[model samples]
Target: MLVERLERFFQRREEARRRDYFYVTEVAKCPRQIFYAVKGFPRPPLDGQTARRMALGDDVHRRIVNALYSLGLAVAAEVPIPENGLFHGRADAIISLGGENFVVEIKSVHPYQFDQAVAGPRRDHYLQLQLYLHYFDLQRGILLMENKANQELKEFLVERDEKVIQETLDRFRNLHRLIFGEGRLPPIPDKSDWEYDQCRYCPFREFCLRDATEPPQDTLEERDTVPSEGAPEETPPEKEGSGKERPAPRDPPPEDGGMEEILLFDL
Candidate 1:
């Protein structure tokens, strides 16, 4: 029992360390969610389904890299980016194809998402790969995705876009200012009707909403202030029965809502 407890403790410590740094993949998420993370707000624990998917993604990444190496392709796995602590990320694998280097990113998605991706790269995925290419000084990258339903594979080639990279950089720089410089929370993302809406299923949804609903400290203090010195003090009304305090009122039920669940692949 003691050994088991020690192992669990170390596991938690390692997980905390992993979350301390911002990753390039997270840049495309809700800025407020990322802001809460960088500000060290406590996040809800990952549900079993989400945790399992993450593990499966990691296993697939390893298998793909090993297969490339066995086929005599020049491959470098888990290539670090930027070498700067301000931002952190690892490209899945850098492979040499026809004597040209390409940053490789692997993803597992549902059939619907795979269909959409086949037509063209998704916005978030496109931006993420662009950052990788920019940092690695490569002109192109490949997004390799597999359909979780039938194991079908598809790949898309993405060229580096300087405009997208600059926009992404500007956003992160602003996020850093909000978090560490001004000590203010970032604004919530505007609502969208997209299939995979980031805010609808964000883990920090409750935290951000709760902060929004609560009254500010100054307002609360003003409401609780006593009357001026010249004003008369009001007397409390006496109860005829027992003076035991009544229970506080319960909160109204939350509105019923749903969002299209998206599978996140970490490489």
Candidate 2:
């Protein structure tokens, strides 16, 4: 029983590690190619003030949704697309009026996200909104930004660009491949242009970026040694174990070895 538990524990650990690696790789690769890739960026744990603000914004958005519904539009708030691998993205406000549907992405940007959108551009937001648009089969969407100054809401209507949509989809698929192909993370780019002010907030920012300086390594060495997708297993045999009848494999496990049990010390 003890041995079985220990084996299961190790297996779980292996699976978790693989998942973590895949996540990092996908996060690193997706953004440049897919405009909406930014939505996939791992969020930092919010502080008390930020958390409260986010909650309030959510409430405000919900209220705005209610207003939309009252205006006699066939509205759906926080509607989800289940067919897309449980993509938990919620459209802040969805309106189907005059036989046309519109996906509304509401943002409570206090000039930071707003400024970034104005200057650097919010590719992630565009990509995510586009994805939502695609799922709903809608060619039009809106980016609603809340203004604290006027206590009024401003809306930006975005028409679906087939080129942008198709390109973003392609990038997403490639990112999916980079993640699940070998269950490993991609290395950070050296010349990672710190164009986004939000880069300072990224956890991997330390490794991928510096104080307005390019990383020492311009490009990561492509390690051919690393396993590729659908590649044949090249795992080596145990150091001292021999032959076809070699005992199950070892205790505590070797670094490169897999889940196959090898009982080192006989009971």
Candidate 3:
């Protein structure tokens, strides 16, 4: 019982640490879930096991980034990847190698995730790194996966796909306008969609299902979006594989050893 209480306390503290901006990871999550989170709807406390797992994951991030900083490869660890003030996310590290820099994204995953993704990086993970590559204006990114049970690691390289970046920007931009600008909640994604597992484990599952305040709008009703305040209209992304040189990798010493970071995109 005492352990359970401790886990609950940690869970609450973690929630309190979450800032108001939609995180970069939001690109890979269901909008309705994001809606429930951003709206501050009440939900049950996460169970002890899940809470412990999450805390452990944060610890792993610290350990890995610290090691990289020591190795002289990491220019910056836990670098913020922000898209205007409305969206925020942190990349694991920015590493300089062979006179070039690449975005590094870390995942502490179950061993099964490794076996399942033997072919290549998972789509969601790729997409998350995609955001990092484009926002950081880097030509390439690396996905680093560490097996939770054994700490075994694998690395995958991804190139910046300007087209995908454009699509995601459009998607997140519209979501921002709908949720904050129009004063409307995001429509529920189709339950049959591949990523619907988020709905199953969602804390607000019952509330989301029972309250159909707005019918599901799969298209996100882009026409209805009013540009959000202080959010800038974005320029077109650079072409893919242009072989252009971006600004060199930032050469910043890792000051703190933890995962806290702050970066913003001007809107």
Candidate 4:
């Protein structure tokens, strides 16, 4: 009964539809998928497990923010970056530490990902934080990850890099022109993009693949696209009669179970 009630409650979620500005986290994902979001394309509704996990993360995120606020560490909580006509997002907090203020973004992660993050912040998380720092004009940012299973914490420090920020901004700005300004979409998934990994979970898989049937007219060179490296590879079929076939894309995240990290950043 509780499961049914919870499912019904979350089913009413209507916010996932579409928007103009890119969420900070979405910028770090497959550009094609992000395009789908901004264009207001149809996608499968969030599954029950995924919805439940988000609810769990919300509870944990709120409680943690309150605790951090009380500790004198947080100068501000749930701070939204002023959408300077490009990107939109909320930092978990602006935290004071060692005489400096850092834009802080927190996450609820599975143990598997938490272990991977011990080396550094997860790729998508850092990308989001990097934007937070650049747009906020802050000197540094913090990525605080909590393991949902056990409440263990992993923290990463990120310093602002103008080079990275500029590259990212240029990329988003171009997409904004095409998506918003020109009413065009980003290019089809490049072979290196590991679109294979992303297609399964993508809301616009059929839409993308169908459009991809035409001759490739990629606006950005394949080399210009950043390679994401996290998903497991499955060798795809060779393209008909074309010597050039796409390699399995390396960077879109498919959850180990159903805990897609990207969903937390979804609207």
Off by over 4 Å in 3: 1-20, 191-196, 212-267
Which candidate has the highest lDDT of all?
Answer: 4
Question: Per-prediction TM-score, please?
Answer: 0.70, 0.56, 0.72, 0.76
If the candidates were sorted by their lDDT against the true structure, best first, what order would they fall in?
4, 3, 1, 2
Segments of candidate 4 deviating more than 4 angstroms: 1-6, 13-18, 191-196, 212-245, 250-267
Q: How far is candidate 2 from the true structure (C-alpha RMSD, Å)?
A: 20.8
Instruction: Give candidate 3's error at residue 248 in angstroms.
Output: 44
> Candidate 4 on 1-267: residue-level lDDT in tens?
698887776763222234567777675566766665555454455656666676787898799889887876879887888857887677889877777788878888777777776457766677788899987889877777888779987676777878888988998898888877886767754645332355445555655665442212332233233323111111112233333335545543334211123221111
The CA lDDT at 27 in model 2 is 24
Q: Mind giving the per-residue lDDT tens digits that candidate 2 earns over 1-267?
A: 686565444331100001111211122232321121221222223344434454666676777778777776637887765455323345676777567778877666554445434432245455667777777788877766665434455555676777776775675566556545543343333323222323323333333322222112322232212222111111112222212222331221111100111111110
* Between candidates 1 and 3, the lDDT winner: 3
Candidate with top TM-score is 4
Clashes of each: 0, 6, 0, 2
Full ranking by TM-score = 4, 3, 1, 2
**In candidate 1, residue 211 scores what lDDT?**
51
